[model samples]
Target: MNILVTGGAGFIGSHLCDLLLLQGHSITVVDNLLLGRKENISHLLNRDDFSFMKEDLLNLPVLKHIFENGRFDMVYHLAANSDIQKGSKDPGVDYDLTFNTTFNVLQCMKEYDVKKLFFASTSAIYGETCDRLTENYGPLRPVSNYGAGKLASEAFISAFSSAYHIQTWIARFPNVVGERFTHGVIYDFIHKLQANPEILTVLGNGEQIKPYLYVKDLVEGIQFICEKACERFNVYNLGSDSRTKVKEIAAMIIEEMGLDARIEYTGGDRGWVGDVPEFKYDLSKINELGWCAKHDSNASVRLAIQKALGK
Candidate 1:
């Protein structure tokens, strides 16, 4: 199978590319290097079955050429403005990057008659809901601009699926933590400790909790769903069964580093204005499909810290 992975030079995207390449599939990556680093995919640049285009997804002409030329068997769209706090700062930037780029991809898919598209959605789309989130959880009241953009893009994809008759899969991801992570709670904590080495300044009250997933587990689960599940439009939540608090994550990082750093907290309900205080997901749907996570939240965080520290 010929696969095109947008933002394939980033952390999760690069790992996805590695998985596809190992499966004996021809992979072409398109990345602009805005947030994605070239070193992520540097090893695969010499492979005969792997190619890359250094371009943004908003470039329709370039994207169209790739679609028309590669004739991709499937597209895994993971490129977008992923920073929730940054998105809250400048929503117009988020809208253009997330919504506009998604529209461009859909247009290219329609023009080239692409068969299937797997979209990377977010758990932020659920906002602060009362009940545990399910696939059927409704109204999509996103509190953050990043979440709003993702929700809007999901709607566009659903509309395109109905109007153009394309197969689409939407996976609402929790906090995906692993190596090569450019920015996130884990990365932030590690960097801060590295810089200070004495006191770690933690954002928020550190009581906020959220679900997390290891990158390898996430990729594996997606592979299973893509191979077995067949639906014009499918939506599922991808996350680990366990949840971890912010303070717990900080302590784990401190322990992993073998440091006696003091944790200082900034009192608040959340780290940021648009951040979700607490949320948990129901992963029974994906688990019922015979795909289960090997690592719990704490174990995943420890592994990610180890990798990030090059230990």
Candidate 2:
């Protein structure tokens, strides 16, 4: 199969590309390199089954050209403004980057007669719900613009699927952590502690907990769903079964890095203004589909810390 991965140079996207390539599939990567690093996909440049284009999906002309030339069988749309904290600051940017680009991708798919689309959605769309989040969660009340954009994109994809007969799969991921991670709690802690090993300043109180999934496990789950699932519009929560606190993550990083860092709380309810304080995912659907996450949140944090520290 010939696959096109948008944002294929990013942390998750690159890992997806690696897995796809290993499966003997030809892949064309489309990345703007705004947040994605070239080095992430550089290792695959020489391979005969891999190709890359350094352009954003927001640019219609470039996207059209890629679509016309590549003629992809399946598209994995992982490109978007994924930062919740940053999205809270400038929502307009998030809307443009996510909704607009997704619209363009759907347009290209419609025109080119593409078969399937795999969208990367998020748990942020659920907001602050008390119950464990399921695929059929009621009324998406996204606190941040990032979640709103993802939900909006999902709606567009659903509409496209209904009108144009495009098969789609949506994966709502939790906090993804692993190797080559550019940003997030683990990366932030590593950088902060590296700068000042004596003291680690946490963003909020230690009580906040959320599910975390290793990148390897995430990629495997995606592969399983794409291959085994037959639903026209399927939504699954890709997250670890366990949850870990932010302070616990910091402590794990400090211990893993062998640093004598003192944890300092900033005294806040959430990590950021629009951050989701706590949430749990009911992964019964994915688990029923015979895909289970191997690493828990704490284990993922420790391993990610080791990978980030080059240990």
Candidate 3:
């Protein structure tokens, strides 16, 4: 299958591209290089089954041209402003980069007669929920611009799928960590400790517990869901079965790096204004489909740290 992956040069997206290429799919990557590094996809530059386009999806004309010429059978939409911490600082970033780009992608899909879309939705859309979030969980309140944009993009994808007979898969992912990770707690902690080994500045109270999934696990989970749950519109919560606290992650990083840094907290449940301190997803839906996450949250964190430290 010839497929297109937007933001395919980023952390999870690059991993997805690697998996798809291994599965004998012709993969074309479209990335703006704003947050996605070229080196992430540099290894695939010579493959006959792989191609990379240094273009932004926000440019509708360029996107349309690519779609018309490339004739992609399916699209994996992962392009968006992923920096949740700074989402509040610039409101327009999510609008222009995330939601607007989604709208354009759907439009191009419709215009090009493409019938399939795989959207990369986030767990942030649940918005500080006390209950274990399910795919059906609603009120769908997103506290940050980043989450709001993802939720909005999900809505557009759903509407487009139904209206145009496009098959769609929407997977809400937890904090994904593994190789080629550009940002996240693990990445930040590694960089911070490298600079100042004596003290590690922990965000929030270090009590913020959330589920983490290894990138390889996430890619496989997505593949499993896409293969098993074929529907006009599908939604699933893709995450690990258990949760891990922020302090645990920091400790793992510090221990792995052989550093004795004092963990310092800024004191808050939420790390930033829009940060959701703790949340878990009921993976029963995907689990029932014969897909279970292999790594628990702690193991995922440890593996991510090892990969980030190049071990």
Question: In order, how many clashes per candidate?
Answer: 0, 0, 0
- C-alpha local distance difference test of each model: 0.89, 0.90, 0.92
| CA RMSD (A), model 3 | 0.8
Query: Which sections of candidate 3 miss by over 4 Å?
Result: none
lDDT winner: 3
Clash pairs, model 3 backbone: none
Could you tell which candidate, 1 or 2, scores higher by TM-score?
Answer: 2
Q: What are the per-residue Cα lDDT tens digits for candidate 3 across 1-311?
A: 99999999998899999999999999999999988999999999999989999998989999999999999999999999999876789999999888998999999999999998899999989998879999999899999999999998998888888899999998999999999887889989999999999999987899999999999999999888778888889999999889999999988988999988999998978788789999989989998899988998899999989888889
Q: State candidate 2's TM-score.
A: 0.98
Task: Provide TM-scores for the models.
Answer: 0.98, 0.98, 0.98
TM match of model 3 to true structure: 0.98
Model 1: per-residue lDDT, tens digit, 1-311?
99999889988899999999988999999999988999999999999999999998887888899899999988999999888888898999779887888999999999999979999999988988757888888877999988988999999999999999888888888999998899999999999998988999999999999888899988887787787778899888988888899999999999989999999999997999689999989888888877788888878888888889888
Model 1, TM vs. native: 0.98
For residues 169-241, write the lDDT of model 2, one tens digit per residue.
9999999999988889998888898899999999888789999999999998999999889988888999888
